[model samples]
Target chain A: MSFLAQSAAANPWFSWAYLRTNADTIRALVVEHLSFTVEAVAAAVVIGVPLAVLAYWVRPLSGPILASAGVLYTIPSLALFAFIAPFLGTGRLTVLIGLVLYALLLIIRSTLTGLSQVPPDVREAASAMGYGRLARLLRVELPLALPGLVTGVRLATVSTVALVTVGVLVGKGGLGQLIIGGFRNNFYKAEIATGAVLCVALAVLLDLLLAGFGRLVTPWRRERA
Target chain B: MNSFNQMINWLNDPLNWTNPDGIVTRLLEHLRLSFGAVLLACLVAWPIGIALGRRGRGGGLVVVLSNATQAIPVVALLTILPLTALGFGARPVIVALAVFAVPPLLATAYTGMREVDPDVRDAARGMGLSRWQLLRGVELPLAVPYLAAGLRTATVQVIATAALAALVNGGGLGMIVSAGFGIGIAAGGGQILAGGLLIAGLALLAEALLAWVQRRVTPAARQT
Candidate 1:
């Protein structure tokens, strides 16, 4: 056999047959990553949106809070994971906490930006119409800011998906297992191909989903198009 | 005299510098990895980013791609790449870092190009400039500020994520952290804390440098 064939034969992970045979495994991996991503992102939105609203209302704390989030963003994922592991222990919970923390900066920034983008005059007019604080927020400010908030969600979604892979390191679920296992076993082709496929597919799917959502939520953007 | 002597003793500690696996060495390695990744990413991403930006037809698509790429967990990517390539080292780490770097560069470049004032483009076209000339002379110059901002974001991200390279045994400041955590800090908590601070300082320095470069390169006209 030729050297290429020899190399391919030697590497189980790289074989087309291996990937084909492991279809069920790959699906499970993808599902786990997706579920974890969704969960973390949802948690982040829950925590982040309120903080964003409070920060926006308060104004003074926004800068500091956002800055601190920015600092958190700078902390490396592995290091963050390691740091939090001491307090949270290993597994999905630790990964979730880290992902949630990571998501906060982007979500908060976008939330603030979205809310602030609503014209002051529009807000004043809403108040003149006797809209209560909650009413004005839900009916006017939120709807106006929905596009940006959605953008933030879109960002958080992609980030969480990507981050869930990191969950593999802490003995949680996802494609990270495939990656880590493949590496430890010296399976180069399987490792590279698996990573490449997942990254590309996840990226494409997320873009399509977010674009669709953006269109649905922001008819004005569509009209402009 | 006793207080002065205590202060002097603190300054002379071996932990301050001379250890072979010192914080300074680890910090340098992390910075080196981050810089290597960013440079590689720029080399790969910039041309593509510029092309996509100039095209302007699929700006949203590019943004989505970048955002998605950015979102992928670093550990996951690191884990997979090395496995495919067989065994772990700096190459896989660099590849992971580069992959992470691409989205921001491409998105920002695309956005910058798209956000260029239509009037400016029209004026350039009106002056009988060809498409290539219009892109080089009018569109690109206008898009630089936004592009710089995007690069600034990418720079910090690359620096931060490069720390993950340690998980794969790629060796960087993360080694200090992971090793410290593995052994428990009582054995070397000082080393780990020092490494963490070093990483933080390097990140700050990178942010400052990139910001400075952005400010310096950006035209005075764009400053407002």
Candidate 2:
């Protein structure tokens, strides 16, 4: 039997030959996965922060805003993608929109909670120091809320990475394509393992990088720690 | 709009309910899988979390681990597991979902146990309550809301991810959606939309029900 046929029969979990042959495909998939994740999360933050600000500014809106996000979050990843694919035509945009919706609840809740946690006295101090509301929010509240916001970003980023794999159902599932493809390709164990491992590693690596970024931005936290 | 009407018409068809691969069967299968996974996860995570919480240690690790597990794509796990000797069935789906569920359940249980007010605990201890009495009477009651919240999160997550079971030859509502996809978009768009709608509706219903339960269980002081 040829190596491919032999490996298919044996179904080994690790095959150097498979990796060597599929290296370019795997690299492209990984890049696709990373880009999808980064873009989705960045978009979610852009949209989520303003919504969080709106919720914070208008106390009545908070309930509706958070509740809507919660509802969106409850929708299954597959269903969310399915719902949008008809309109978006089953590719990057559909996946991106679904991911942003999923990430919103986490980001909004964290940002709002972080902003709320900023002490009233500190706000008064900022105001007393001749700061306007926007200035206070930017200089005092946001600075103080950095840890929580960063934590939310990390959570959103990680979850987005996982959900991006669901895009495979629509032909945009980055590493997810490899995972499902391996399964359909005669239970190719090495391919499935490689895809799964890379996804998890990517999640962990990005989370750590975000954590580092969080620490770097909030130098005062370092001193306290 | 045309697709929406078709979806409505598809949902209304009597045969769709009574057929072998009908909505009712798929729904029941989905519910069964979700319930089993969540139950198994609770069994595995609750005891360990409670023990750690009571000790007031390992909470940080539990939190970190829980957050880390959020990164694990359920689809990947579902597909990867059946490749083992488990081999293409509900068994691997259940096992994968259970693993997916452990983190939130475990983390919440730990937090619930740890969040009991220290002063209340001290008062209970001073009143000559044994460790057992303290746990049962004081800590557990206070922890109910947190446990409920954790249960809610786990159930919702499991239900959503359980849809992927169809990919592994595991029975669930996912099979409906997958079947719809198999027929191609032009002919099967209505079926696809219907399946997606059903799954989304089921998940939302579960979320609302659990949120109500969480509210009911919470101490009145903590209702907000």
- What DockQ does each prediction reach against the true complex? 0.28, 0.73
Clash pairs (backbone) in predicted model 1? A159-B71, A162-B72, A162-B73, A163-B73, A188-B84, A188-B85, A188-B86, A191-B84, A192-B84, B66-B103
Residue B93 displacement in candidate 2 (angstroms):
0.6
Give RMSD (Å) of candidate 2 vs. truth: 2.2
- Show where candidate 2 strays beyond 4 Å: A1-4, B116-139
lDDT on C-alpha atoms for all candidate structures: 0.74, 0.88
Residue B177 CA error for candidate 2 (Å)?
A: 1.5
Best by TM-score: 2
- Tens-place lDDT per residue, model 1, B1-224, is 23234324433576845558655676677777777887888888777777877666777777667655664667766766665544466777878888878778877777788788888888989999999999888888888887788788888888877776766777777776667556653444444444455566667777888889999988887785
User: Which residue pairs clash in candidate 2?
Assistant: A168-A173
Q: Which digits, one per residue and each the tens of the lDDT, describe model 2 over residues B53-84?
A: 98999977897787767878887888887767
Off by over 4 Å in 1: A1-9, A12-35, A188-225, B1-21, B47-61, B71-73, B76-89, B107-144, B184-194, B219-221
TM-score of 1: 0.76
> What tens-digit string does per-residue lDDT give for candidate 2 at A2-104?
8677865688788898899999999999999999999988998899998998898899999999989988888998788768865666668988899999988
Candidate 1's displacement at residue B177, Å, is 1.9
